[model samples]
Each structure stands twice: as C-alpha cells, then as structure tokens.
Target: MVKDQGLSIVHVCQSMDLVDSVVRRWIKQHEAELEGQPGIGKPLTAEQQRIRQLEAENRQLRADNDPIKKSLGLLCARTEMTYRLIHQLQQKAVPVQQACRVLAVSRAGYYQHRRRGERKADVVASVQLKAAFVASGKSYGSRRLCRALQAQGVIIGRYRVRRLMREAAVRPVWKRKFIHTTDSRHALPVADNVLDRQFDVAAPNRAWVSDITYVRTRQGWLYLAAVMDLFSRKVVGWAMAPTMPAELVASALCMALQQRQPPRGLLLHSDRGSQYASLGYQALLEQHGIVCSMSRKGNCWDNAVMERFFLNLKMERVWQRDYANHGEAQRDIADYIVSFYNCTRLHSTLGYLPPAAYEQKMAAILPIGVSENT
Candidate 1:
C-alpha cells in the first residue's frame, strides 16, 4: 500500500503512527524496491501551521465587530453553540453549572418558542412588541415602548403597551406579587404609619421604600431585596441570594441604613412580607429610631413605591438580562441598581432628575430653603 500510494520513510511514520511498525516496514520494503524516491514527507512547516490557526481566530474576531453580522443572528447563533457542550455535559450530570455566570440573557424570555399548545392570535405585530417590551423588563413602559417600536421601524400607537402585554400573557414579572414577604400578623407592637402612602414629599431623604424582586439564573432563581430612598427614587442598598432568607432582606436594609444615615425618623415602609415583619427586621428599624409601616395584606397600593421599583426591575433589567451563573446575576443586579438606577435613572417623582442628582441638589439647598420635616 505504501508503494502504491505516495509514501516515503518519514511520511509513513507521521501519517500512520498507530501502525508505525507496519508503516515503517512497508516504507523500507518500498525504499529497497526503489532506493530513493523524488520528493516525499514535505508537509507544512511549523510557522505555516501557526499562521493558519491565527488567521482563523482573527477572522472570527473581525466578524464579531460587524453589527450586521452579529444582529442578523448568524454570529450570535454560532457563538451560542459553545454553550451547547456545557449543556450536554450537564445532561449527563457533569456538574458544570454555567448558571447565568457566562451569559447575559433575559430570564423572563419565552425564547423557548413553542409551548405545549399553541395559541394563535391575529395581533402578530402586537405580540412581537410585547416580547421586546417584556424582554426589556418593562423598563420601557409606554414612552420607551414607542421609541423601541420606532427603532424597529414599526409605526404603531404607544397605547399598545397594555394591549400587547395582555395578548402575550407575558405581563411584567413583578406586577404586585400578592405573596406578601412581611408577616403583619405578629402580635409584636407595630409602629404607626407616618408616611401613609404619601410618596410625594419635598426635599431629599425624607422618605424611603423597600421591597424584594427575583431573577432566574442558571444556578436557580436569585431573590433580591432592596431599600430605596423615595425622595430620589434611587436604590440605596440591595442583597441577592439563592434563597430568600429573612437575613437577606435585613442585610440589604442594614446596608442602606449605614450608607444613607437618614435622619432620626426616616420612614421605612414595605409590604407585609415576613422578612420585613420578623423581629430582626422590625428591631433593625427600631434600632435606627425610624418609624416602621406595612402595607395592608392583599393591598398592592399601600406599597406603591416598592411596587413601582419591582415593576421597573422586572420590566427593565431582569426581563432583558440572562445570567450565565449566580455570581453574574448577583453582580450585574448590583451594578444595575447602584450604578445606573440610582445615579442615572430619571424619576417621574423627582421632576425627572436622577435620584442621586436630585439628592445632591436638595442637599445644596436644604439649609437655606424648603424648611420641611420628612
């Protein structure tokens, strides 16, 4: 066979090393038949092989930079294939937990496509818009929805926010979870309501709200509890965990307390979730000398501030982001809450100034004007 094909001494060893003895004997016999063959075993040089591999990698990187290539879903689909191996390993219990650690996908997405039974609706366009909006974590709402739809080159009424949501049955994730967190049923003396749903207040740091939201990641769903200063509509502190333990809620509250150092009687309000109603949570509130209040059970309106925050989180950030693992989800949520939401987000309550900017402006003027107690 070696003689029948173009094979020589060195070429035979390199090509069929598994049968090296046979290959070598064949080559020797062929060589004995003809002492020296013309040109053989002249494969690519080491440098040439390296250059080809490098060029292949460079080509892929360049492809990634081209927006059309990436957005057309060709590049994205190709790139996501790397995750397939991890998923395959997971199927066999390989214990490789990518858990939103490596990816950033919208958890609430119905990207799964087909459901058990298909429900066909005439409003295809509306359905598409709703998917995008919910994918946006409801952050876009009506106005942002209009802008996003326009960007997609679809000229439709802004009112379609509600319409599309209803059609898709994909309402924003945290639309007032009737499942309360704080247990107001306790006999422990509850503090009187001072804020009393009065979200609109002058100046800054006068009022604050707290609530919890959840995000689904590869590891599992991570629950996030946070406290926001209503004056600026900014998140002050937040904690995330694989489990929604009471400490998770209190830790976030403590972080906020240490950071803001609100006045002697800052109003801390939240729902009747046990996390808030527990002795530890209530004690933390009393320790800070702040008044405590709970929204009436089964009432979403009483905690509108937190409800709005949850709505924003579910609709804007969590809806659009997919976490590869738990760490990524936790870290990303922290950035979204602290970096963007608090400092850059425009609050309708603060006359459009971001929470941080609103607070800074208030601190600048509070000594001379707006003499009012929170």
Candidate 2:
C-alpha cells in the first residue's frame, strides 16, 4: 500500500493484466530506492547459521595445524591426544565399544604405542641402521650392526633397533658361495708374482689387482671381472659377461688403464687364470708399460689381496642372498662396490675408516713426486 497515492482507490486497475503490470511497475520503482537500503528479509535460517559456524571452526583448525605442518611426529601426537581423550571418556561413563570406535584405534594398539614409542625411535634408528646395513651389505645382524653403531659414536640399545628393524622388515642382504669359476690350465704364458703379496702401496695405482667372480641367474651364470686399486680397494673397473674370455678381462683392464694412466712400473697383479694368462691381456700391460704379477701356479694365497677382496664379497654380501637373475645381482653388486663398500663401508684394516676416507686422508698428506719405480 503506497501512502504517496493516499487517494489510491481512484487509480485502481480493472483487469488482471493491468493489475499485474501496475504491481510490477511499483516493485521496479521500490527496487531503485531499496538499492542503497538494508534488504527486507527474515534472519538467517538454522542450517545457514550452522554452516557459518562450521566455516569459522574450519579456519580455527587450520590455524591450529600451522605449527605442526608436514611433521609426522606432530600428527602422531594429535592422534595420541584423541585416543587418550576417548579412553578418559570411557573411564568416565562412555561405553568401551563406543570409545574405541570414536578414537579410531584398537585398544591394544593404543596401549602398545603408549608403552613403547617405537614409531619415533624406529624412524631415527632406520636412518642409522641403513648406513650400517649398506656399509656391511646386509651381512651384519642386529648385533654386528650395534657394534658398527658403537664404533661410529652412536649409543643405542641393539634390541631397540632390532625390534624396529623387525617391525619394518629390515634385514641385511643375503650372500652365498660360488666355486669352480677359475681356470688356470690353459697353455698360455703366465707372468711372475713380482709383487709377492706385497699389497701395501705408497700411492695411488702403485699396485692394481684384478680378479673374477660368478653370479647365478635364471638365464644361467654371469661372470664379472674387476680391477681394484690396492690403495683404496676401489673397483676402478669391472666388466660383465655370460662367458669367461680374454676380452672380458681385457675390457675391465682397459677401464683401469684409461682411468689411472698409472706410471710405468705399476704392478698389475692377478691369479693365474687363463683370462689373465692370455696374450691379449699381457699385450695390454706391456703396451701400457705395466709390470705383470701373477699368483703362484696352484696357490690362491699368492694373490692375497685379490683373495681378501673375494672373501669380503662372499662373506659380507654374496653368500647372504639368493638372486633370481643376473641383472638383479649385477645392480646390487654395483651399488655395493661403488656406492657403499669403497666409499663409506668402514674397514677394520684401515682403522675402521672407509676406503674413500683413507684415500682422501692419504691424498691430503702424502708428498707429490713419489713415483712407483722410485
């Protein structure tokens, strides 16, 4: 009812269409006036009010989580809080079944975690354990792993990390033995044992040792030959093949040659295997001006450095695991030799220092110009 047209009865519409048109025109006129004014409507509905409250609560929860962002430990603490709250509520009259359901936990798990914070300790132990594990190539059990940690200045109970490793299914890699890979019977010229088990070196590439090992695979067997620097015990070069041949060992020797351009008079040592006895391999040493050193005809002990390397590979890594195929063995062996064994695995012979560490120290202190022939 418009008070502006107080004599309203005089201008009334007679038909429905006219009445509708006049009503619309009046609404349009009022809409313009209402644009800057408060809207005429009922207050918020119950559902609308609940939705607004939920939004505010959500914002507050976000603020609460800000302090613990991306921290699993913080998230775990929150979970524990919920569990504790539910437990307390049950003690104070809530039903047991209801409490467990609301807490989102099994009663046993909640109590177990409370009694032993394994998750937190496990995470920390795992980082340490991994270094030791890789360093030892999974050969060391919890006991040896514990000793390794002690040597590194870490103080933690063996059983504690053992339990965590068990829970995480952490186990040292498996190794196994292989025999009959060596063949020294071929009618080829054998070099003299010039170094004569003298494995110690005054500098890099002074004495290089080479050897062969076999790995079993589904396709059959694979052979790997490696050349190591006696100074660092590093696998300076290695080659893999399904068959034993001169070329196989030659390729590995070539890699060592290219890498170390070792000075003339560098002693190249190996077991009296046919591959090492071959003309191709000897020619390589002669061309590079290297002195050839071979093991005594039937004695493995003559080439002690090569023997020790194989023993470590066998007992510490190979003898502990079974490979489904050659490729897997190759990859794991490569990772062990280059990534862990030489670089970081502690050696008792080197005063528990890793090969790389020992080499770095030697390189820093040793004076230059100490040639091998000197």
Candidate 3:
C-alpha cells in the first residue's frame, strides 16, 4: 500500500494510524493485490486539498460552459432544451454572443428558436407570444398572453400558448396574500356600496375604486393607496407613505381629480378604512362633488376591482424584491402603475386592452360627449 505501489506512506500511516513498516508489511502480504487497486488517498496538505477542490470545480465549470457536454439534446433536439441551454448559459454568465458563436447558431435565429420552444410551433408567432408574456413582467398567464398575441395579429390558441409556456419554463409570479385590513369598526360615517361589484363600465370615469395595501421594506412597512378608474381598470391615482393615514388616500383622490377632472357626480368607491371614512377624505370627495361609496362591513368582495389591482401589483412587482427602504418601493410601485399597468398590461375585463389604450380606442369611436359624463 505504500513503497512498492508508490502510495503516500505518510498519508496511510496518519489515516490508518499505523507505522509505515506495518503498511509495508501489509503490502508485502497482499502482493497478489492488483496494481492501483486502492485509489490514492486525499491530498495531505490544506493547499493540496484546495487545489483538488478547485480542479473539481473547474471541471464542473467547463461542463457547464460547454452546454453540449452536459446535454446532448441541446443541439439535436433543438427545441425546449435549446431554451433551457441558453438559460443555463445565461445563469453561468456566458455572453449571448459567445453562446451563439460556440453553438454555431445565429443570434437572431437562436432567440427565435428559444422563444418559440417547440419545433412544431410557428416560430414567429411563438416569439411574439413570449415577447408579450415577458413584457408583462411574467405576470400574464396563457389567457392574457394569448389575447396580447392576438392583438399583435399573431393568432394562437390559449392551450397552445400554455404548452409553449411550459416548454419555455415560463410562469407568472405569484405572491402570498395577507389578511385584509380595512378598519370598518371605526365610528366614522360610512356610505352604501353603490358600486355593487359592477366592474364593467362604458366610459372612463363613471366610477372609481380605491384601496390601501402595505409593502414590506427594511425601513418599515410602506402603505400604498391606489384609485382605479372602474371603466378602464386603470390606476388613475396612487400615493405611498410610511404610514396609513387619511391624507395618503386623500392625496391619491386629489391626484385623480386633477388628472381626470370628471363631472361632479362621478362615483368613488372604497373600503371602509378609517382613511376613507375620515372627514378629510370625505371632504375632498365632496369638494369635487364625487359620490362616496363604501364596501360592506368587513367585506373585501365589495371592492374587488381595487383588490385585484393590488394583487397584481404585489405578485408582479413589489413582492419580488427586498427593498432597502420605502423610497425604493415607492419608486418601483409608481413605475409599475404608470409605465406598465396603465400603458402596457392587458385587462381581461376590457377585452385584453390596456387601460390607456382602451380609453383611447373608446374615445376614437365613441362620440365626444359620450365619454365621462355617461
């Protein structure tokens, strides 16, 4: 085991706790043993051990970098596995240019392949479908993605879109829901639930729904107050603060008032939180002559549209990150509202059109005076 076989006698002695002579004698007695029968012992010094570890890691890295070495399907099958390979390379920090060059694939062609996923699918349509899904921040499932794809003149079925999503390993993000915190126990005055879950509206500002939700950040919990125009399911106004106060919601209402300037009797509905019930918020609504509507006591379903918006917000954006402070969360939420949700996201209730686009399309066709006042 030592001298004759050229084994590390010192390592054998230390590991087996035997004298070198004893190992030598044992080797002599076991002369019939095949050469290289027992493998070499572990590296003796820490540096040598580290070198061994690095060598193993280097081998793993090489296998990862060379995608074909790990999965033969990457080149030949050339379908879902290809997307997975590109994704794996991306995870390994391999540049897209380098990956395409090594794989002998054109960059544009490879992306088209990766996006479509299945070889049988229409490559262009699949790419467009994936583009829509990704543009929604992976928040649009097959139903919405299909609608978006059709809007772009790429007609595809929902189940087919679902299959492509599975092939691409793409899924919408989901967030854990917290308990509803509407403080309906307050002694403040509350109004009737006039909105009555009638989410569909013919015009932009016939009614609006508002709600308050919280975001967790390192600094503290940041509260978000959003007012959504029911007609278009658009977040017309929003405000964020470290505390849940009447002023937060009032500010959101004020923003909506300034932005829309709808007729005096526009219905504004919200949960019976103390903020919405406060004289300040009520007076702001009164000043604009907006009708006040509240959800039934402890019933979140009454404000379902606004609740859905909050659900979308947390699942798609806020819950995905660990914000260091309220400022970061506030900035991100604002961007999500203005840049994505209002402008780009597809609302199922509005025939898959985004809020802004739906409003614009309606205005283009409907008579001028038939918009808000209706």
Candidate 4:
C-alpha cells in the first residue's frame, strides 16, 4: 500500500490511531512476505521467472551428467585392475597371452608386470612371514601364520603359507622339555601362602612373584631369578648368575626395587626355597618394607604364573640353543628377556599383548604404578 498506492504513513496512522513506529515496524515485517503475491503486492516479472526456471533445469542436467563425466577415469582404473588380475591368473597356469588378448591389454606389458608383481609378492611375503615368525618367537605353524597374515589384510591360504615357509627356510622352533627343582629342605622359617593362586591384582606393585630357574651350559649351570608384577605380568626385574644363592634372589629384588621404586608393604610371592627364605633375603625384603608370601611346600601350582613364564622362556629361546658357556647363556637369555619376551613376545594372559605394553596401557587409564623391564 505504501509503495504501490502512494499512501502516507502519517495518514495511515491517523486513520488507524496507531503509533508511527508500530506501523513502520509492521510494514517492515510483512514487506518480504507480501512479495510476489497478487493484488496488494509486487510479483516477479516474466524475465526473472524465466531465469529461475533455467537455473533449476541447469542443476538437474548437471546431476544427470555426473556419472558420464566420471566414466573415463573409472574405465582407466578398471583396466589396470584387470591387468593385475590377469597376471595373478597366469601364475595359476592360465595362458598369459590369451588372457592379455581377452582383457584388451598388450602381451608384453602383461609379461613385464607379471614378473615384477611376482618378485614384489615374493619379497613382501618373505618379509611378512619372517616378521610373523619373529613376533611369535618362531613358534607359529602354518595355521598361525595364515591367521597372522590374514589379520594384516594379506589373504593367504595355510598350504600357500606352508610352501612360502619352506621356500624361506623359516621353520618353527621345536619344543624341548626341562625340569626346575626347588630346594625346600632348609630349616628357615616359611611365610604362609598369602598370595596363594590369586594372579589378578588391582594395581601394579601391589604383589609380585619371584622364582629361580636353571640353564645348563657347557661350562657350568646358569641360574636366573625373575620378579613378575601380578597386574601386568611384566618381569619387573631379573638377575642371572652361575650360582643359586640368597644373593641371587636379593640381587633380582634390588634390581626390581631400583627400577620400579614401588611403595612399601609390597608382597613378594615365591616358592619356599632356601634362597628366598634365607636371612639375607629376608633382611633385604625388610629393608625395602616388602612382605614375604611363600608358596606351599613342593606345590608348583601355588606359583603357576612364574612357572608358566619359565616354561615359555625355556621352550621359546633356551631349549633351542646350545650355549658354550655361562656368558653365552646369560647373553642369549638376557636378549630373550629384554629384546623379545618383555617387549615383543605376546602373552595370552595379557590378552596377547607383551607385558610392557600391557602395563603402559593400564598405566594410561588406571591410577597404577608403571612397571619396568629388566
């Protein structure tokens, strides 16, 4: 009314008895809504309506043309994919020339790419198998190898994996049996089995298990004392020597204490061996404010976690070697513990994670102490 009919705001407000600002605000609010309406409003002209129709048609045409625009790129990528497929088929006894001709590719290119792809595949498979074997401590058979490869998105059958293993000459480590003897004939006082079989712990440094295992060398016997945290199953400390004495166990405990610096009143669980129950070992534990928890007399099941670790250490690394002397045995065992077991070897108890990784992962989420490797 104001623009088209040339009406005055003052005359409208006088006729309606309304404030000037209120009438102006009402006109401003309805100005957009009244556009393009008939009679009391202005509508789009024919040229403007034609442009809007053209824009709608343009959008529809572009959407319809999109698939055709991408078809050329798709065709080129498909040809390369087909070339690789033909190469793989040729390796399985398909005629390379016929496959190349049928796929509409050059026979020379097919042969060249096939050779390159095969060499690349062989190298890739060799590396993958070797990594899988080393990660498994060379303990995986073809079934495990196939599963490991498949987990990494490498689709390979077990029989094919077996052939690759044979070609690579990477055989699984054979298991060897051994015995661990604990001397419980001492007259030293034995603590009650406080830890018992409770392998689960709420936090690190709350409880630890220790044990002594012997390794036979050409020069003499090498003994290893290990301390494991119950929470993460990490070997927090270890000591290796040619003799199994109270100092051997004390040295391992000292290494654990110096590395972890765990809080006081930590429970130390072990078999009732004289080394663990000797005065020196007891006094050392007392000095660190650590308590003692002994396993039952001659009961190996009471300390099963430590026993399992020793079993893995022997079967995976020790039993496969012929150490010439204690030095060789100590060096190899230390490598297995530091380089492989604590850092690389997967533990089923820790959900297939190495103990160090498991502890670090737990430490990130839980309010627990961090464990250190030997």
Candidate 5:
C-alpha cells in the first residue's frame, strides 16, 4: 500500500495501528527492496520475497548435490583406488553400505576386496612388492620387480606384481629424453673411431667409454665426466666440476687409471668433444700407455655405451633431483654410482646382475692362469 498506492506514511501508520517511526522505517526498507537491496527483516514486496525464496532453493540444491559431486570424482578413479577410498571412509564412521552407494561400487565387491587384502599371502605379497619397488629407487617396472621378488623367494609372477602395484598405487618414476652435451665442432684433432662400436669387452679395463653430461643447480651448471668399463657396464670412475674443461675429464681418467691400473694397450673411447681432444688429455692417455678412440663426427652411436650410461644416469637419478649446489649434486650422483648402480641396480645386459656383482661372480669362476680373453 505504501509503495504501489503511494499512501501517506502517517495515514498508513494510523490505519495499520503501527507507530509512525516504524511505518517510516518500513517505507524506507520497502523502497530499498524495490531497488534490489535486501533487508534483515521480512520482505515487504512480492519481488523481494520471490528473490529470497529462490536463494533458499539454491542453497538447498547445492547442499543436495555436494555429496554427489564428491562421489563422482571418487568414482572416476581406478577401481582398486576407489575401494581403498571407501574403506578409508568406512573407518571414519561412514557406513560401508552408504560409502558403496555414494562411490557407485557394489557392496559385495568392496567386501571381497577387503577380504583379499586381509589374506596373509596377499598382504605379504603387497608388502614385498612395495619394498622391492622402493629398493629400486622406484625405478623398476613389472619385469624387474618380479625378478626382485623371486630373488627374495617371494614366488610372485610379473602379472601378479603388476596387479599388486595397481592395488597399492605404486608406480615407477618416468624417464625424460637424454640431452646431448658434446661440442665436437672445435678444430682440435679428434682420434679416429678406433673402438669401432665394439662395446663388449672380455676383460675389465680392456675397453672403456667416457662421456660428459651437465646437471642443473641453483648456483650454476655442474658438469660430470664418467668412465664406464664396457666389460661390466660399471661406472669405474667419475668426476664433477663447475666447468667442463679438459682437466675435468682428465681427473675422471686419472681416477680410472689410479683405481684400475690396467695393463698397457688398454683402449679408452669418448666423443670428439674438444675437451677429450685437448693436447693435455691426449698427453695423459699417451703417458698412461692407453689408446684414445673418438666417435665419428655427428654420430653418438660410435660411443653408444657411454651414451646409454648417461641416459640411465639422468633417467634414474640426476633428472629426478633438484640440486641446490654443486657439492650436493656431486655427492648424490656419487652415491648413486657406488651404492646403487654398481652395487644393487640390476642390468639386463648382465643377466640382471649389478655390475659389481657380475664382476665378482665372473672373477670367482675364471681359471687362475687363464685370461678372460683366452
């Protein structure tokens, strides 16, 4: 009556038996509501009342749909993962039947999964599978994981291991492509491809391949030079420096020489990077009575073993880290080479034996007077 009929506030107050101040306040509130402003008290206009009713309906709809949205997201996950989630919900005072309905999973299936998890053998297998995966630095897939379980007398197959991995939500870290760091365009003299891709060697120290790769750090790039024995695919020697100078590679070579002390005529191979071709490096090779072989220009396959080693290094260790400084990266990489790669990591090429283990096993079997080559 106050807004549409434009009745005077005093007249309306007298007619409705309301106080004059209350009628004036209500008139102001009604005018504010006409302009789409909501007040705390009852809505006086039809449009304002309709707006309030819609808001209440919207709130109720959102409340009704929230559980459904959450359940839809959970249902979209893997079936085993969904079952695990439902079990977790059940532990939190949520009814199993309700959780199953919300997750769109059959109650019978959820119960079955829980029973399988409770079995002694299944539980043991799951634990062993996870333990083996972690022991491989989370790097082993189903094939190697199965072999590792068998080595421990677990009697698990590859397919079963894969299934358990899914149930346990275990997965290996993925590998990124290897980046080439070789700069062979310098005018320095590069040795011929004398090693000639003969990556297999009958005796340790008979042939070795070396390569350089860079690691990123907060401070700067750290260059790593490594020498691997082709006989065992072992990282015999490695050195890290803030810069990739000729001395960096020389230090790695010196370590290899000091460690192995191979006989004269040992063959060492590397890319034609200028550091490897430096006169000082060549002099060190000559002084040690070692033959220096270089990969052909633009061909990484000539030093393929070294390339593969770098790839494995980055994929399995270096790429997975975010180094804060040179020293940290150096130490971590050294640990990987000594503690993991040489000591524990399985190499398919060596019949799944680690390089160090393979070397030891071969040494124990070799005849005392006969050479590995013979």
Candidate 6:
C-alpha cells in the first residue's frame, strides 16, 4: 500500500498500530520473497510456511516410527516378554516411556511387572537356602552352607547365606565341652611314639589313628571305638558296646583289618589306655604285622585327628539328640558316619569334599595299586 497508494511508511505503521521496525522488517521479507530468496525468522511467504510445517511433521513421523520398528515382533509376544524387551531397549539408550507407549503397555504396568519378577526370584532363593540348611542336619555354618548352595547351582555368597539363615531363624548345633578319661597308669607294656604326631598320610591305609568316646543313653553309657585312616580322615571301622573294654577296641581294629587288608608295616597309633595296651590287642597287632605306636602319657594331642573326629561326632549328632536307648544312638551314629559324614559332609581338610569323594577323585588322578611309600 505504501508503494502503490503513495502512503508513507510511518503513516502505514500508525494506521496498523504497529512499530516502525515491524513495518520495515515486513517490507524486507516481502522483497526477499519476490526475489525467491530465503529470509530468517517467521516466513512471510505461503510456500515457505507450508514447507516448514511439512518438515516438522516429517520429524514427528520418524520419532513415532523408530520405536515401532524396534518393537515389531515384541508386540505379539506375552506381556512379560514385552516388559523384558522394554527393559532391554531402555538399557540400549531407548527411552522407556516411548518404548512402552509404542508397545501399547502402560509405564506403571511395566514397572510393576519388574517388581513382581524380583519378588519371585527372592522367594525361590529363600526356599533353596532353607532346604540346604535342613539337608545338612542343621550342622552347617555359613561357609559350608554357601558351598552347598553353590554346588546346587545357586549363586550366593557367604554373607548372603548368613543373612538368609538369620531371617529363617536357623542355626547350627553348638559344641559342648567334655572330659577325656583314659586308664594310662597301668603296668602294661607301652610302645614308643613311632607315629610321632604325623597325621597327614599320603595314601590310605598308610597310617591309622584309633580312639574311644562315651555316649549317654537311657540304657546307661555306651562306648564307641573308631578307627580312622589318616589320608582321607575317614572312619574305616567302628565298634560300640556297653563297656569300654579291650574287647571293644579289638573288635574295631579287626573290622578295619578285614576291610582295608593293608600291607605289612602299616602304622597304628593310639593313646596308652589299658584297652589299647591289653595283651590281646598287642598280640593281634603283632599277628597282623602292624606297628603299634603309643601316645605320650596323658597327652591327647598326639592323637589329635581322632580327637577332632570324636568332637565333630558329639557336636553335630550326639549332643543334638536325647537317645532313648543304645540301639537308637547306635543307628543314628552309624547314619552320621556312613551316610552323612563319609558321603556328604564338607571337610575343610579335604578341600571341602567328603571323605569318600576325596578318595575317589584321588584314585582317578593318582597311580593305581601303588602305596604312598611305594
């Protein structure tokens, strides 16, 4: 209007109630449009405005299609699977809100699904922990229980196992103090300390340690004599009777002889009790060509390995039960030795393997039919 009607630019600004700079900018934009040149800021031409609108729509369309392409087959999958995909996409720098929206899932629902899965996993872990504790006869502490759970394919740590044990209100049996009574002041012949505190034997049947412990039952005291092969710390033989007599120890030695049939020169060490020093027991040792080694007078540490076995027996099994009779105690003790102790218990000395398993594994790796000394 200023160019064709001879109206001044200032007059046009006043008529339109606009500032002078605004009118000047509009005129410059119109001149750029007539010359087919692009101008900055808001486009004054119709074609440029339509082009800007289409560019914005194209950007919005690409943003909407990107998540859809990433979640193609996932849309037909289960809701749980969809949530898992959403989680995976979020980890790969995809926005969770956008992914959930494209997959037709509510953001709150996806979060709730994740929480439910976590709770389920916790429940399964608790159940497995409880089962392992019970299977150990409530005798395993956190270290052993952690190993047990790992063996069962449960990935857990010792601290976590301890926490679970506390939550479940489960605990291992505690050991009690007991006195040792040995009749060592007898006039019977005593052998020298030939074994000499060498508890670690390189092969089975190379060395054996024997000891006797007393168990209380309703039928009075029951004495148990056990023979252990020092190599694997296994109870090779054991005998139980109402009295702690020479015959009881003899029977135990005989059982060990029949089972192992070791070569001559096998060393058998024991405390200098009357039963171990009895004429019959010494003669049996001589007849079998076994070497008899006696511990120092009143020194139990000489037979520390056997002493430890007895301690474990008392603490883990005998002390936990009120035995009604000798037979019951005998059966329970046998089960602990044969089924649990020898077959399943984790021995720290044996690299956390059971006695039987340790022996088997060594047999496979070591030479066949050759003694440790050989």
Q: What lDDT would each prediction earn against the true structure?
A: 0.68, 0.76, 0.83, 0.84, 0.86, 0.89
Better of 1 and 5 by lDDT: 5
**Comparison by TM-score, 1 against 3, better one:** 3
Candidate whose lDDT is highest: 6
- Most accurate candidate by TM-score: 6
Give me the overall lDDT of model 6: 0.89
Q: Give stretches of model 6 more than 4 Å off.
A: 9-29, 37-62, 65-118, 175-177, 189-197, 368-374
C-alpha TM-score for every candidate: 0.52, 0.58, 0.66, 0.62, 0.66, 0.76
Per-residue C-alpha lDDT of model 1 across residues 165-233, encoded as one tens digit per residue: 565664544333333344456655554556678987676566788887777787777788988877667
Each candidate structure's count of clashing pairs: 26, 11, 0, 0, 0, 0
For model 4, what is the error of residue 27's alpha carbon versus the real structure, in angstroms, after optimal superposition? Answer: 82
| Per-residue lDDT over 1-374 for candidate 2, one digit per residue giving the tens place of the 0 to 100 score | 44465434324544332575655566565675678754444479999999999999999988977665546455577667766777678689997567777545677776676557656666777788887776675666777677688877877788976976787677865545657878888888888889888877778888899988887667778888999888877778888888989899999999878876778878888988898888888888889888998989788887777677777776776666677887888887787788777886667667767788888887788777753234
Model 6 alpha-carbon miss at residue 43, Å: 14
- When summed lDDT is taken over every stretch of 10 residues in candidate 6, the lowest stretch is 365-374
Give Cα distance to truth, residue 117, candidate 5, Å. Answer: 9.5
Root-mean-square deviation (CA) per prediction = 25.0, 20.6, 21.8, 18.2, 20.5, 5.4
Better of 2 and 6 by TM-score: 6
Better of 4 and 6 by lDDT: 6
Tens digits of per-residue lDDT for model 3, 197-277: 888777888889999999999998899898999878888888899888889999898898889889988999998889999
Model 5 agreement with the true structure over 1-374: per-residue lDDT tens digits:
87789988888888989899877777777778888988536546998889999999999988998887678656775578879999799889999999988766899998888787767687889988888888888888888898888899888888888889898998877667445677888889888889999987777778989989888889888899999999999998899998889999999999988888888888999989989999999999999888999988988789888877777777778878889999999999999999999999989899989999999988888677534333
- The full ranking of all candidates by lDDT, starting with the best, is 6, 5, 4, 3, 2, 1
Candidate 5, clashing residue pairs? Answer: none
Ranking by TM-score: 6, 5, 3, 4, 2, 1
Candidates 2 and 4 compared: the better one by lDDT is 4
lDDT of 1: 0.68
